[model samples]
Target chain A: MDTIIQGKAYVLGKNIDTDQIIPAEHLVYSLSDPEEVKLYGKYALSGVPPEQGGLPQGNIPFVTEGTFHSDYTIIVAGPNFGCGSSREHAPFALQVAGAKAIVAESYARIFYRNCVDGGFVIPYETSVPLTGVIKTGDELKIDIEANTVTNLETNITFTLNPLGDVFSIVRAGGIFAYARQENLMAQS
Target chain B: MAQTITQKILSRAANRKFVDTGENVWLNVDILLTHDVCGPPTFDIFKQEFGPDAKVWDPEKVVVLPDHYIFTANEHAHRNIDLLRQFASEQSLPNYYDVGTDRYKGVCHVALAEEGFNIPGTVLFGTDSHTCTSGAFGMFGSGIGNTDAAFILGTGKLWEKVPESMKFIFEGDMPEYLCAKDLILQILGDIGTDGATYRAMEFDGEAVYSLPVDERMTLCNMAIEAGGMNGIIAADAVTEAYVKAHSSKPYEIFQSDPDADYHSVYRYNVRELEPVVAKPHSPDNRATVRSMQGTKITKSYIGSCTGGKLTDFMLAAKILKGKQVTVPTNIVPATVLVARALECETWEGVTLKKIFEDAGCSIALPSCAACLGGPADTVGRSADQDVVVSTTNRNFPGRMGSKKAEVYLASPLTAAASAVTGKLTDPREFL
Candidate 1:
């Protein structure tokens, strides 16, 4: 895993739930089916606001086309981010959308665990609130080893708490790979 | 060292004599539950990571129920169930409950209790947030993501962090008009949504123990709304009687030590509480029904794992016996057993269904019908510009349907009285 990650930030508000991350309507796809799985990436963050259809009062859209490429790779949000539902698709959607890491003031437990278990994205817990400090389209450098996030645009830096075993899991590319490396699962 | 109920349960599951807060340990999961919405993705991951030829650790330990969107005829919805059935058959699973069949149970949380899978002192994981409902049985129940669930399917074990415990003591006698829903809503209102984040909310004291198992389930079901890891009540005669009636599985009960460490403690005198409602867009934005009296409602809903139990239906029926509903009301039983009980249950020589139907209310089949807002064709979903007073747990924007629609979360009694008046009327008015 890269100890230092530099990417553009995507800013979101408080209490963004799994439903809003990837609505239940788009959960019909199966990973085993190639055709169905392709829809997941396309529908990623499709519920974000200003995008027509679904949910009358839409939320602020971080990724306009629901696809994250070179720009807008890190998500910075307020408290209780990813609050509803136990859908791993929330993280999978963000991972497929190219979110390298998420720096939030606080997170709902299930969403936090999903990100770590799936190794889809790195969840950074910020001791200081990042909502006001970080802005959309800002270049950021996240150092996992130092637990520090620095704004490359300005020289401001925020401290984050190490996620204990989560660092190892992300380094190994998810729980499945970690388990296999430790011989926790039977050999195929 | 003294241990709380959560500590004891996790210790036992981890096969350790003791475990402390913030410590991560691998636990042997006794039961893993999944539904249509989450099961397919979980199964997909299980197959992909474990390889196509890999078998489940124990088929009997895994329970699959196609509940959430099964009632709808949408092709995608059907495809979800089809995939679950295909996977269950491939694994030769024993506990697969198919919809449109007699074995079909309703919501996975309710079924987990009714089927005896919620044994005390064991760890249970489900793909839905309300899986904490099983904690009412004195078990350690929490929700997990598809990846973690897939790991459990292959290894029958998953990692967990021991959380600090928050003890909530409900003292004094509960008033006749109040139920578990009001008590929990009151707590949520006071604590705010994230007050109990990453902690276990342990319910106790005279009032909590006096509640029936089903009512206790309602209290634990909404713990997730407060951002709690789980909500648990120690096993007592009430819990034992319910578990014995439904399951013959061997189980053990655990309790917190008197010196158990608690992050915080809260007390509530049930006698002073009233029927409260969580207003539009947030479960913690609460107000007493008396204060919000006459707030117009376009529809009324009495269902979901939180409020769609036999006790909830019975309470609503008592208020709607002879009254006609002024708004469109939908009554959904949480489980097949609850639906059957409603059919056979009578008040004033009329079945509960008859009373609801006579009051101009419609009853739907036993599933999570419109609680999560299934397909657009779902029976009771709220439309644009609609204001609904419902007994469902969440009132988040676009939770029931249409982000423009407003939802007021309430108890069944409050819901019934609101339906009769087409406004948020206090149940005490009808009583």
Candidate 2:
């Protein structure tokens, strides 16, 4: 895994819940079917409309029609990101929607673990609020080893807490890979 | 060194003498739970990661219950249960509770307790976030994703970080109208939704211990709403009696040291606390019921792992005994056992279900109906522009049925009373 990552930032506000990430209606999809799993990417953030206390009206889709976009790789958000539901689909949907990393003030515990264990996305915790500092389409560079997120658009830098052992799992490409590498799983 | 109960349990699970907060360690899981909503996905991951020939590490430890979307007649919803049935049959799992069968359990959380899987001083993980509800038994209960659950399914172990502990001591005598639900809402209001993020909320002191185990479960059930890793109470005589009657599993009871270190300590006087409600859009947006009185409601829901326990219905039945609900009100028992108990048990002379039915409330089957805003046919789902007072946990936009519908979260007393007046009403007035 690269120690430094650069992408365009998409900003969201506080208390972005799992229902908003992927509504209960979409939860009926079968994960075994590749076609159904792809629907998660398409419906990612589907519940977040102006009427549902999300981005004001007429906002562009974060993940356009389930197609991964290299431009929208980073998501910047305020505190309590992924606040409701224990669904790993929230992070999985964000991953399938082309989110390489998430920079938030704080995250709900289950979402944080899901992102790390599933290698869905790199979760970055920052003391400084990122929602106000970063904007949509801002070029952002995250340096994991240096514990800093630099906004190339404005030339401003923000400090981030090192994820410690969690970074090791991320570098190994999810928990299954890490467990295999560590010989935690007995060879069949 | 004095260790908190959270620390003690983690150390045991990790097989270490001591584990500090923020340190990650591999933990051997004791109990793992999954339901219809997440079970099929977890099984898919299990099969994808581990070959079809691979068997579960321990079939007895993995429990499968179809609860969340089972009440609906949707084909997709029924398909999830079919997958679980197939998987359980293939694995020969002894704990699978199939829907519409003699072995059917209602909600997974309630079933876990009734089946005695919530043994004290053990680590419990579930696919649903409210898995923290087991913490009422003094266990380290937390929610895990499908992938992690799959890993545990195959290997019987997973890695976890030791969380810091926050002690909340509720002092003074609790008021009659106030339940554990009100106390927790007050705590949520004092500390915002993320106040206890990545930390354990250890509830204790006079007021908490004075309540019944069912009510204590309600407190732990919503700890996730505050972003708490888990909510726990030390196993005392009350807990021991309940566990002994429900389960035969051998268990060790653990307690926090007298001088254990906590990240922070909050002391609340329950005597002055009033009945509170979590207003529209947020669980932490709490206000006293008295202040929010007369806010009209179009529906009333009294069910979920959080508020569908036997105690919750008993309280609601007390308020709705003779009065008819002015709006559409739905009463769902949390489990089949609870449903049977409701049918057989009576407060004065009338059965609990009779009390609810006589009050013009529709009693639904024991399932997670309308809690997560089920299919179009789900009972008690609010219509667009409708306002509902529900006993379920979250009240976010579109949480029930329509994004345009508003939801107010309150205790069963408040919900039942609100159903009578077609608005938010204080339970004390009816009492």
Candidate 3:
């Protein structure tokens, strides 16, 4: 848990579904095998219809061709982000592609759970839509301790909704870690 | 305290007398379902977190159905099935339905009902989003990610925030042309995709009860599309008859109290509703089939957990009895049981299989083929810029195969009728 996280932003429109996050075709690869796992990163957000892949101008790829990682580590989007599917692969792909945080108006429930429970990316909800304010390739900083995101390009700051009940789980680095700390799982 | 049916079920699962909406509780899960797509990773995480030799919380309580990507030549897909087999064997799990075996089931959601795993008053959690389909049987069923599913696999328990309930009442007799697909699409159009987020949708009224169990499953199956935590219909004699016919396991029935509270209630008259479709790119992008008529389509697909059931096929068969499809149409059953039923079940004294074949429609072997744009070799996958009218749920971009393609999510009636004209056609045109 780094309190201050900063990176280039990748902005997207509303209802960025699981299929668009990681296309169903690329879901066959292993999430654990180090070599196979890179495929997840290579194809992350590959189904976003290209024109809608990146915000503002669109047609910008989230991950560059032939690379497993993305230069943009923060994703800023509109409401109802990650609205379809329960594939944990959605968030895993984003994390594998080097996304550190997501600032959106809201999220689909299962996707939100997967983000925290899997300790993949920090899904932060904002009261205002950030997709319009942040441009792809714009620098952004997320202060987890302060619960605010600042656009380094515009020097504008926005308040993010508190992580609330799931914050401890996210802070503990996922359910398994939290469970162990709370002694919820029996020792082997 | 007057609690909604969902609250009551959660209360029972949490071993508490009452559970309030918005409060989190650790629930004793009745069943944890998984399939090939998510099962391998979930099993891997289970081993990584719980140790290599850890046994499941309860073997019988976990159901693994290998349906997705089963027929694909993709080696990774095959490897996933092998992993499921390895894990199931290591844990001595009895509910494992392996591919290439007699016990193989196609889609996990529909198969859960056919195999008697969906019992009322119980709580089910699965790795697949459509697991909420089981909630049709007056149970609490919701989807979770691999982490939560693996947690349940290891502990038989997981945490959940009790959802507020939303009531939907559909009155009057269900019209012949309108099926559950239309009714659900109507709701989606009204509420939009994320309207019911973190809420329980309860279906009621004469029309809902008049529907067969399979139709009810259709209503609940797409609850996830609305971002609903679960969709439930109280158990009636019809539910009991179906459950009794399928399983001998004892179960409890629960219902919402007469004075229960709901976040909101929506009312509709079945007579006022018409065949509708969720136009391409989004499930909430709904339009009346009549309004979208004459829209040319390249293909028609009828299959998946949502639309591949026997009742769905029966509806399609009614419209395609003697007509020839002008476009390529694929009929894939959700389960082997459904495939067998198509051979025996008759419409106008003709078996559905013969009807589809005679109508020039291709009937593929059962499994979730092309519903999710599987491997390149998947059947009925949409080609570049191809427009498809499909009975399957979710018409999201690239859902069937090609990102350039578009899909119109409609009832089997609409899909079949549209297939006849190679254009989006209202079922009423043929009915």
Candidate 3, residues B35-117, lDDT tens digits: the string is 99999999999999999998999998999999999888999999999999999999999999989989998999999999999
Best by DockQ: 3
Tens digits of per-residue lDDT for model 2, B142-256? 9989999999999989888789999999998878798889988888998989999889999999999999999999999999999999999999999999999998888888899
Candidate 3 accuracy as TM-score: 0.99
Compute the interface RMSD for each candidate structure. Answer: 2.2, 1.6, 1.5
> By DockQ thresholds, what CAPRI class is model 3?
medium
Candidate 1 local lDDT, B1-431, one digit each (tens): 99999999999999999999999888999999999988988988898988988899999999998889877768988998998999999999999999888999998899888888989999999998889999999999999999999999999999899999999999998777998999899999999788888899999999999898889999999999999999999999989998899999989999999999999999989988899999987789899999999899999999999999998998899899999999999999989999999889988899998899899999999899888776878889888889999999988777887767889999999999999999999999988
lDDT of 2 by residue, A82-178 (tens): 9988998888888877778999888999999899888999999888887776777889999988989999999999989888768788999888998
Per-model chain A TM: 0.85, 0.87, 0.97
Better of 1 and 3 by TM-score: 3
Candidates' RMSD to native: 2.6, 2.0, 0.9
Output the lDDT of residue B210, model 3.
97
Q: Pick the candidate with the highest lDDT.
A: 3
Error of 2 at B8 (Å): 1.5
- Residue-level lDDT for B267 in candidate 1: 91
- After the best TM-score superposition of candidate 3, give how far the Cα of residue B212 lies from its true spot, in angstroms: 0.5
- Sorting all predicted structures by DockQ, with the top scorer first, yields 3, 2, 1
| lDDT at residue A41 of model 2 (Cα atoms) | 77
Sorted on TM-score, best first, the list reads: 3, 2, 1
* Per-model DockQ: 0.54, 0.65, 0.76
Q: What is the model-wide C-alpha lDDT for candidate 1?
A: 0.87
